[model samples]
Target chain A: MAINWFKYSSPASFYSLAGKMIPLFAAAAVILLIMGLYIGFFIAPTDFQQGEAYRIIFIHVPAAWMSMFLYVVMACWAGFGLAFNTRLSSMMATAIAPTGAMFTFLALWTGSLWGKPMWGTWWVWDARLTSELILLFLYIGFMSLQAAIDDPRRADKAGAIIALVGVVNIPIIYFSVQWWNTLHQGASVSVNQAPAMASTMLMGMLIMVFASWMYSIAVILKRVRIIILERESHTTWVAELQKDGVA
Target chain B: MKPRHKKLAMIVAGVAALGVASVLVLDAFQSNLVFFFTPTQVAAKEVPIGKSFRIGGLVTEGSVQREDTSTTVYFSVTDTSHTIPVVYTGILPDLFKEGKGVVAQGKMSDRGIFKADEVLAKHDENYMPPEAAEALERAAKAQKASLSE
Candidate 1:
């Protein structure tokens, strides 16, 4: 009898599917990023005053946006796992943790580089910067907590609770400039209002954001496949796949 | 109750409480979050004098002056259209240079000079820390290429 596809949520089925999706997403990520970079650097018009220093926005803003976005995504998966007792969901959250942390680190590091030229400082304890730093720590804490624990199920539950609590910071990070007299600038592109920047610059930034989103999906999918393999090593499906030369 | 489960619960609660406390503390101090404004913004009277804040722009050419003590440096930050003079005393970041982006945190004096408590030098994306010379070279090349094109 053929097994139901949805039952593959049992880890064995999701593993094969994740493996199939990784290469496709990776190819899309590479293509979109290269195209986005070309438009950002070569084709975009230079700022009248800031000149090339403004180019840093293409990478900085997108990475910053993605860092926050990926955290929320991780939290959602964790929440689902906690609520439904779904093993696949928690594994997906675990898979996304490292990449999310990397993006957060990248955002902070690149923001510092951009900030030095624009703000004249390598670092500050300002609202936006401070909150972002906290996000990084949260990511680290989640990963460490998961690794330090011997039992995977207990680790997932603990990590899920932490992730849920960390969600409070996400809104604070996004609204820091508006809610407080922050050192950081207000939003340049709001959902309801027109963008403060030139059209070309906005286009470039948006394209880069899409590219980053694609890249995250690609990396997370790849990581999820490895996680499934390790977690399901004792399963009969894994044994069958290995015997079939498909592992 | 299992001892192990109790310990895990306590740890999780402790972390969550810490996170909540920090957010509250940060929120309480939110009023002090001052951001740097460009010389153009200052010129437009967007920044109030005698109010502690930050000002950021490029160091105007030939505007840097060193006090006899060698620790104090005075310079004007400009965005071509506007200029704000700044006074700072301390070892500046290695990346700080003339005609480069700078942000100084302090109050604008009655005399219109920005008296800075701190100064920060901005670096490029490709730059690694503690290597100002290489970043300078790259900046120069980028500027030259942009101007030529």
Candidate 2:
């Protein structure tokens, strides 16, 4: 069966498709969160050094990964919208920003809590930390720039430019610990090396990562539906849908 | 503005922003990027005397000593080619042990001893932190480069 994927690319069609997907993704997210947290807090062995405090890595590493990954995804969507002038792509970019920012904030806050016990300070100006702080600023800058402009098209173009430029910071953040003498420790899990933690810990962390991924997708879909309504409020189809209580 | 002009404006704006960002990145990398110095750098007089900095490497075997006073501890950090004695007055992190990775932040005395205000052990025993491992590799590379010269 051939499905015309392009049909769903339109905002009106995507709104319904997203509505159908939200509940499934949201359910999976909830289930995975429960399982991941259970395994993370219960099944994973206590560290030989960091003790129970090291358990924070279950949430911290996943949130950190999502923060970086979501930014790249946002930039790609924004770039697509800029190049193709697709309204839905730009709407997706806007929908994703807040979720990405939330994850970034979570990563930093959890990292500070983890640091207080291990590093003896709540924060330090290490290269990794500083670059991550810059990432947070970039997110805020993108949102603020988008909001400041009254025209939606102008806002999308401007926000896209900022998001694209900010992509450079992603590599810097990942490589900061390796490139500089930083107080922040290096990653335990790398492509070329075996993960330093036990198998159970790795499993739990991976599950948590997927949970966060699904959660973001669900939330972004819901937000994008609202954005569609806001942008197309004056259109006949949108008005009909709202009148029929379909929206 | 026409649609064509809008595209041009976006292109120009993106290019300008990227150019500015690249300059900031370069400046940050050059000035604020602190490279880890191995014991070799300390021995070769490469590190500054008065300025506080971090030294990272494996704790030399049989070098950790605890005074009866319990607050002060002594150890030597090494990258195999050289070793620098570190004097720290604090409780050591759980992973601090002989033949393990450590980073000590403090100033160095004229007599070659590191007076550490803080001592940090690596996250695990078997696994060296990537930053510390990379520092060792860099120091070794520099040594090889000098030998070839």
For model 2, the superposed segments whose C-alpha errors exceed 4 Å read B1-35, B124-149
Interface RMSD of 1: 10.1
Candidate 2: residue A44 Cα off by (Å): 1.2
lDDT of 2 by residue, B36-100 (tens): 67898788877777999888898999998999967899999999999999999987776677887
What lDDT tens digits, residue by residue, belong to model 1 across residues A1-247? Answer: 9878786676776777777887887888888889889988988776644557778889988988988999999999999999999989999899889988998999899988876766556778877889999999999999999999888899999999999999999998998876654546677777887776667677778889988888888888888877777877898877787899964
Stretches of model 1 off by over 4 angstroms after superposition: A1-8, B1-103, B107-114, B119-149
User: Candidate 1: global Cα-lDDT?
Assistant: 0.82
The recovered share of true contacts, given per candidate in order, is 0.18, 0.19
lDDT of 2 by residue, A1-247 (tens): 9999999999999999999999999999999999999999998777655668888988999999999999999999999999999999999999999999999999999999987777666787777888998999999999999999999999999999999999999998999877787777888888998887667788899999999999999999999999999999999989899779863
Q: Pick the candidate with the highest lDDT.
A: 2
Tell me each candidate's TM-score: 0.70, 0.83
**Candidates in order: C-alpha RMSD to true structure:** 10.5, 7.2
- Report chain A TM-scores, every model: 0.94, 0.98
How would the docking of model 1 be graded? incorrect
